[model samples]
Target: MTLLTVTGLTKSYAGADGELPVLAGIDLDIHEGEIVALLGKSGSGKSTLLRCLAGLIPPSSGTITYRGRPFKGANPGTTMVFQTFALLPWLTVQQNVEVGLETRGLPAAARREAALTAIDLIGLDGFESAYPKELSGGMRQRVGFARALVVEPDILLMDEPFSALDVLTAENLRGELLELWDSGTFPTKAIVVVTHNIEEAVLMADRVIVLGGRPYGSIRAAYDIPLTRPRDRDVPEFSKLIDTIYRTMTGRADTPHPPHGLRQPAKRTPANTPLPAASVDGLSGLAEILQRHDGHLDFAELTDELSLEVDDLLPLTDALELLGFAAVKGSQITLTDQGLAYSAADVQTSKQIFATAAIEVPLVHFITTSLRNSVDGSLRAGFFRDVLAHHYTSEQVTQQLDAATGWGRYAELYTYDTRHEEYHLDTVPS
Candidate 1:
């Protein structure tokens, strides 16, 4: 049975120039007896979709139905577990767990009983009387779980619930949750989790839905997990699935099963090819690592060796790709000749190489050309920000400018005066 159905969902927020779309034409269904993981990088609208399902935010357009009924406000059949734990600092664990019940008008005694039961089930029975400050990160998250579960809604929504915890703690919590789920004592009929961690999604979800970032947030692909519970990460099938997901997320066009959504434009622009939030040092460090590995490295092995999540590493790789320094095919990242030279060159030579390569990046090119054309070899930052405002939200404009500023400064293409908010052409020779 389908617990939730979303059709042609579109969500947008007010931006400087106009409405900025966050999610577009999202079509999804949350069925009973399945854990669906919404996986995507930052800005993919995973959390936005989850909030839409929870009815915390209204969609700009489209329909959401719960058990065949139109969803109007707070979803009666859903409760959310947040990444931040969101517990009242002054409240005891039991009181925090009972919050939803209190709002639902359950009698005090009954709420207490239910909260205790949930606390016990989530391995926090002894912590019920303790304040949130008295608990560790894992235990606080357990309280968050208990609080959400105490409501016993038909659908449970989690927004990066494990992201705030340490690796061992998160692993342990995931195991405990799965054990409870397998024991058939878990209250919810369905679970929807938002995450950027690909492995976490593969490990915990019965179905994984990948969301794309470019153009807007929309489902790129959905895969059903056939592996049984307690999946082995070391197995070949697991590794293969992870690799496939990596390829999909990285937008490998030749990937066997192409995702169903907007393809990145053949012509790159500042709007479409926004600079990845990576620094010069970060991308250069990765290139040096690739140089050490003979100009190529399997994506998975590099991620493991660096002990970084896919989200953490992707920005660096994206930056390298944007700068024409690297290429990613399937699960392999190969450093290009430009990348090799940049990695091997001395400081001054490397900056020159980077400047030449960075100019190919649309935003960087735009900034450099605009500065060069200026009568005084300078322009106010507001001029560029206003030009970009048409294509991005205010926050996005800031990020774009910041990225461009960093690259321009490092390449000596331009120098930004923090106080004056201006960009000046670098007169010094490389």
Candidate 2:
């Protein structure tokens, strides 16, 4: 039976320029006995789509249906496990689990029964009175899971539920979740998990759906994970599946090498291109790794070697590409001479190299130019923020401005007074 259906799921927000579209033309159906994993880059609206599904946020346009009824504000049959455990430190595990049930007006005895069952089911049977701060991160997230599961929803929404956990803890939690799902005893008819970890998606999901590329998120591709449960990652098929998904996210591999000294010129990005947030130090570290491997690293090979998801590694690579430190084509990431030089340079020289490349990014250039032309050689950061409001969401503009501020200071292009939230020219062009 179809448990959930979404169609033409267009979402947008008011911006200075016009409506800034988020999810566009989204169509998806989750059926009984299915676990659908949504995978994507950082800003691809994976979380937004989940919020829309939960009816926590109204979409600008589109429809969500749960069991043939139009979904609206906090669907009665749905619950969410947030990435952050979202547990109240003051509430004990049992209390936390019963919070939702109590709100639904379940009698105290019934709520206690449900919470006890959920805590036991999630393997936290003895921690009923332990508060969030008393439990470890993994233990706290177990309470998050129990809280969601205790409600006995028809569908459970998980937003990168395990991404915040340490590796071992995440793996343990994923195993337990799969066991409960596959056991056929869990109350939820279906589950939708949002994650950035490619392997985690493949590990726990029956169907993997990727949301990628453009910020106006749409389903890029969906793959049925052919392997059976309790899957082995070392198997050739598993590795191949990871490679296929990576290539799908990156849009194919196997490009010929660029010229000896220079990388391919960057494609023009949007004026509000949410500039890469990976740090200069991180990008240089990746560059040095690629340099040692002959200035090229295969996509799948790097993931296996570094044990990093594409989401975790892509930002570093993107920063490298943006700064002319590397060129990524398909599965191959090859460093340019500039990248090689940066890797080999001392701290001061590396800063100059980064600055030379960073000054060309539109946002950085805007800040530099704005400060240079200021009458008093200074301006409030809010000025650029106002300009960016035309291009990005308030949250996105904040992140962009923060990145630009860090990169600008590192490049010696300008100085940011955090106390005043102001920008000042390092050297006024008189």
Per-model lDDT: 0.87, 0.82
TM-scores of all candidate predictions against the true structure: 0.79, 0.85
Q: Kindly list the per-residue Cα lDDT of model 1 for residues 245-299, writing each as its tens digit.
A: 8778876453222123423244656765688888898999999999999998987
Model 1: CA > 4 A from native: 14-19, 254-277, 292-311, 336-338, 352-430
lDDT of 2 by residue, 1-430 (tens): 9988898787766553455566777789999888999998766788889999999989777789988899567777689999889998888899999999988899999999999999999999899999888899899999999999998898999998988899999889889989988898887999999988788888888899988635467788899998999899999989888888878776532333322332332444334256877876677789888888988888778877888767678888878887788887777888999988888788999899888999988788888888888898899988888887765667678888888888888899999999999999888887
The true-structure Cα RMSD of candidate 2 reads: 5.8
**TM-score attained by model 2:** 0.85
Which candidate number would show the highest lDDT if scored against the true structure?
1
Q: Count the backbone clashes (under 3 Å) in each candidate.
A: 0, 0
lDDT of 1: 0.87
